[model samples]
Target: MRFVFGKQDLADSARRAEHCFLLTNGLGGFCSQTLTGGAARNDHALLMACTRAPNVRWNIVHRVEEELTRNGAATHLSTQTFAKGSPEEGWQNLCFAQVDGLPRWVYQWQGVQVEKELAMDWEQNTVALRYQLENPGDTPCTLTVTPWLQFVPKGKNLRKTQTFTLRGNRVTAAGLDLTVRTNGQLTPCPLGWQTLYYPCDAPDGRRKTGLTAACLQVVCTVAPGSRQTLDLVFTLEKTAPPAARVLRQADRRCRLWERQGGFRATAARQLAQAGAAFIARRDSTGGKTILAGYPFFEDWGRDTMIALPGCTLSTGRYAEAKSILETFLQYEQDGLMPNLFPEGKTAPMYNTVDAALLFIRDVWLYARYTGDLDFVRRAWPVMERIVAAYRSGTRFGIHMEPDGLIAAGQGLDQVTWMDVRIGEILPTPRHGKPVEINAYWYNALRMLAELAATLELDGRDYAALADRVRESFRAAFWREEAGCLRDVISGTGQDEQIRCNQIWAVAQPFPLLDPGQEARVVATVQRELYTPVGLRTLAPGDPAFHPVYGGPQKERDLAYHQGTVWPFPLGAFYLAYLKVNGHSAAARRQVAHWLTALEPALREGCVGQLPEIYDGENPTASRGCFAQAWSVGELLRVYEALERSVTDFFDHK
Candidate 1:
C-alpha cells in the first residue's frame, strides 16, 4: 500500500495522454450535452456525456441524454439506455494505460518491473506521465487505450476548434452501449472494438461523433520494450454564456490525489498550494478545511478534517490548515462546527457528530506534526465550542448522557456520505450513538487534552471527559454476544446486529473497545462481511442484509446502503485491524496479498475505476456509480497509512 517516489515519471511516461489546454475543475456544475456550468472551473468534469439508465424506455427521462457544445452552438445527444448486463455486469479492458502509480491491486504488469512502474505528476497548466509497459510476446502489439476524461462547463460558447501537440493517431470511435436488462442486469451486448478515427475542426471537437463530453480513445502499436509519447492540446471559448452554477474565474488547477482514486489527471500539488494559500488569501480569521468544490459548502468539517493529514501534513500546507481552523469555528453552534452550508445560507448544518470532533483531532494532530501552538491557540475557541456543543444539547438531540457516553440521534440526513435515503433519512432506523461518530468524538476529546496541556488551557476537563465517554461507551454499546459495538442505540434499545459502520468504534483513532473487543470485531467482519469488491454493509444473517445489490427501481434504491458492500469502508477496517493487532512479519506479506484483490477492477474498469459499492452475494460485484469520492478517499487513506507503516520501518532502521 505504501507509495514510493514512483520511478514512472509523469514527464517521462513512454505512453501518455495530455490535453492541449487545461480542462476546468468541475466541482458543482449545470450541464447541457456539450457545455457545462459550474461554480467555477472547479466543477466536476463534463468531459464525457452521462448516460445512466437504458435509453429505449423512452420516458424522455430514460432517453439517453448528451449535450453538445461549441462557442457558437452546442449539440444535444440522444442515445439508447445503459450498456446492458445481459450476460453479467462487467467492464472490458478498453486500452492499456500509460499512467503509473496505480494501486498495486490492479494491473498485474507482466513484464514491467516494480521499479519501472508508471509515474504521474502535474503542474498548474500541465500533467506529465512516464510509465514502462513490458510485452512478453515477441510480436509487437498495438496498445489501444482511452483515458477517461470528464468535461465540465466552459460556457455556452461551447463550440470551439482547438489544436494540441499530437504524437499518436486517433482510434476509431464506437457508440458506448449502456443498456440495462431485467433483474437490474446491465450491458449484455458484445462490445464493439472501436475503430481508430480522429476528429476534424467541426464546431465542437466531438460534435461530428455526436459526443457531448467524454475521453477520446487512441491507439499505439509498439514493439516489445517500446515506448511512445502522448501529447494533445484543448481549445475552449465562451459560447452563449455559462450555465447557472459557473462563476466567473481565472484558470484553475485541480489536485487529484486528495482522493487518490477516481478520474485522476493530477491535481495534488495545486490543491496543496491552493489550500496553503487559502489562509493567506482569506479575509477571515479562523481555520477552515479547504473546500473540495465551492459555493455550496462553506466548509464541510468532515471532508476538511479528513483531508488534513494528506492535504496539509503530508504536502507542507500548514498555514492553510491553520486558517481553515480559524474559518471553521465561526459556525460553532453550541459545541459543533457547521457541516455544510447550502446555497445562500449564512447558517450551516450541524448534522454530524464526527466532523467537529474530527476537526479537533486534526487541529491537535496538525499542531503536533508542525510543532505549532500558535495554530492551536487560533483554533482553540471554535474547538472549544465544538466540544461544548457536544456536551450541551443541540438539534438532532446531540448531547452527553448521564452515563457519560456521547449520544446523538434520529435525523435522516444525519448519515455520512454512504447515505442512500432521499427526502427523509431512510426509515431503516440506524440511530443513536452510531459507532464511528462516537469513536471520533472520543478521539477528539483525547486530542483536545493534549492541545489544552500544551497551550495551558484547562487540560483537566478534556482528559476527564475523554475518560468518562470511554467508560460509558464500553458499558452501554458493546454487544457482548457479537463481541463488537452495536451499530446504534434506538432510545433505550441498542442495535446488536453487526454493521460495517460499527467497525469505526474499534478501528478509528480512539477505538472505544479494548484489544480483545477490537480483535473480535476484526475477526467477525473479516469472516462474514469482507468481500473482494468491498465490505458488506451488514452481515448476511441480518434480515435487512440484501444479498443482491441491484434489482428493479425500489429494490435498487433500497439496497443502495442496506447490504451493499462498499470497498472504502474495508480500507479503514483493514488498517484498524493492522494497528490494533500490531504488524507481524506475516501481516505485511498478507497486506501485499490482500491488496491484489483490488487490481482486477482498476485496469479493466470491471467494477470500473473502483465503483462506490458492491452486491453482498457471490462475486460480490461492484455496484453503484463508477466513482465515489469517499470510496476513493478511504482507499487512499488506507494506502497512505500502509505506506507510512513501511516508511516508518525504514526510518527506524
Candidate 2:
C-alpha cells in the first residue's frame, strides 16, 4: 500500500494548501490543488510516507483551499465545506492538493470557516507531520478535520467506525491503553515508539503495547487563527487475527476532545485497513507479482532482495518472498535483476552488482527461516542458472574470477551510486576481485552447497570452491597499508585506499575476512568513515572527498559518494559492528544513539518517509532522494538484528 502526499519540503507554500493520498494500486485516486504561481517550480515538495502495517489501503483527503457559502442572512460570504466535490468525478472536483509532491486533502467538515493542510517528514525511524489551520468564517469554525490514513485488507472499500473519549484537552483513541492528557501541549508520545526504526527492533519494540484501550485520555483544540497540532503516534502491529480485531476495536473511538469520533476512527482505520489494502494490491498485480511499495518503487530484484528480510520476512511473508524470487527468475534474461522494471513494462536492467547475489542470500534465509528444503529444491535450478550466467558474463560484465572471486562492471562501474561525486563512478574494479562481490559469491556458494546436499544434489565441489574464495579473499582484499579492506584493485595492482565500499565487506552475505580482520575493518570504519548519521563514501584524507553540497549536475555529482553519507550503509555498518563485537549493552546504546538522531527527519513532508542520501560534509547534510526504499529497509533490518541478538542472549541463558 502507499501513502500519498505533496511536497518534499517542510514549509512549502503550496504544501500549505493541498491534498493527496497514499494509494494501493486500487486506490490511486486523483485530486487538484491550486498552485501559487512561482510556488510551483522552486517548491517541488514531493509527498512521501511509509508504513509497515500489513494489508492497508490508504487514500487520504488533504486540505488545499477554502470553500465559501453565503451566510443565512445573505449578508456576507464565509467558508463552508473545505471539500470541493461530489462523490463522482464528473459530478464534482475531488478537493485534492499536491503540497509539493505529497498528496493531502482539503477535508470536508461541518463547521465555520476552519481549514488545515497536513504534511509529513521522516524523523529517522518515526513519522512526523506538520499541520496548518486557518479560520476565515464568521463566528469562527470549529473545524474538526481528522486525518484519515486508510489501510484495507479485503473486499471493496468499506467505511469503519471510530470513537474518541476525553480526559483533558488532549485527544487520542479513547480505547487505546495509552494515557492522554491534553493541555495545549504539542509533544510526542512516550510509548517507546523507537520501533519505527528501519532495523526492526525485534521483541524490543514489538512488545511495547500501551496499557489497554482504556489506559489514557487526551484532546486537542484549535481556536480561530490559532492552529494547534498533536503529534499522534501509534505503534502499529502486523495483522494477526487478534491484531485486526484489536485495531478494529480501537478504531471505534469516534470523537476525542473537540473532534468527532469519526475523525479518530478514520485515522485508526488506516492502520487496521492495511491488510485489505495488501490483498487489494496483491490482486491488482493481476496475480503476477507483488510490488514492494506502491505508486513509487515496483518490485526490483535489488530493492525486493534488500527489503525481503525486513519488509516481508519480519512480517512472516514467506510466500510473498518466494513468489518474488519466482517472478524475478521468470524474467531473468541477461541475468542481473533488472535495475528496475520500466514504469509500465516487464523489461529489466542488469547493470547492478548486488542484486542477484543478494537473491542467493534471501533464498538461503527463506529456507532457514522456514526449514523448507523443498522450496530450496524448487529454487535450486533458478539459482544454478543465475550463477551460471554470472560466472559466464552478462550485461554489466559480471563473472566468476579465476581466483574464485566474484566481480562485475568495468571502469567506474558505478555499480553502486553510494557516492558518485562529480558524476564520476569510482573505479571499483568491475573486472576482478571486488570485496563485496566475492563475499556474496562465497556466501552464495556455501549456502547453495549446504542446501544442495540437504536436497541430495551434487554439493561436493561447491564447498571446496567456497572455501578457496573465502580464504583467498582474506588474502587479497586485506590491505596492511590501510587497516580497512582494499576498496578496489586495478585488476593487476592494489588501489587500497579505505573507502565506504569496504563497509560492505564487513556486512555482505559472506565473511571472507577472518573475524579479526572484520573487527579491525569495523573499527577503522567506525573511526574513519562512520558519522552520527551514516558513513562517508570516501575518507577525509582522500582527494576525492567533497562534502560541500550544491545543486544538480556539478553540485549533485560532487556531493554523491565523493564525500556524502549513505543512511542504508550506515545501518549495515552498525549491524556489522554489533555482529563483530557482539551486542554489549554499550553497543546497543550506541545503536540507539546513532539511529535516534534521525528522529527529526520523521517530523514531516519528506518524500515517502526518509531522506535517500545525506551530505558528505560535516553537519553532514542529507543529500540525494528522500524516502529511499533501501534506506528504510536497511535501517529496519539493523534494528531487528540488534534486538534478535539481545533476545538470543536471553533465550540461551
Residue 459 lDDT (model 1): 79
Cα lDDT for residue 433, candidate 1: 68
Count of clashing residue pairs in every prediction: 102, 118
TM-score of 1: 0.60
Residues 507-557, model 2: lDDT tens digits: 764566777888899999988888766777778887767776555455556
Q: Give the candidate number with the greatest lDDT.
A: 2
Candidate 1 regions with alpha-carbon error over 4 angstroms: 1-301, 307-327, 344-347, 411-418, 422-425, 491-494, 551-554, 604-609, 618-621, 646-653
lDDT of 1 by residue, 1-653 (tens): 12212223112211111101112122221111101111112211223221211000100000112222223332221111111222100001112122222211112223322111111111111111122344454555433332322222222212223111112222122222211111111111222221111121121122222212222333334465554432222112112122111211221122233332221212222223223221212223322344432111223556666655545555545565566666666666767666664433245677766777777777766776578887678778788777777787666777877766667755565545444565663735555666677778887887788677888778788888888888888887777886677777666442876778777776566556778887888888887788766788778887777877554445676776667787767766767667666766566567656766766544322112345566776643344433333444445445545545633311110
> lDDT of model 2 at residue 497?
57
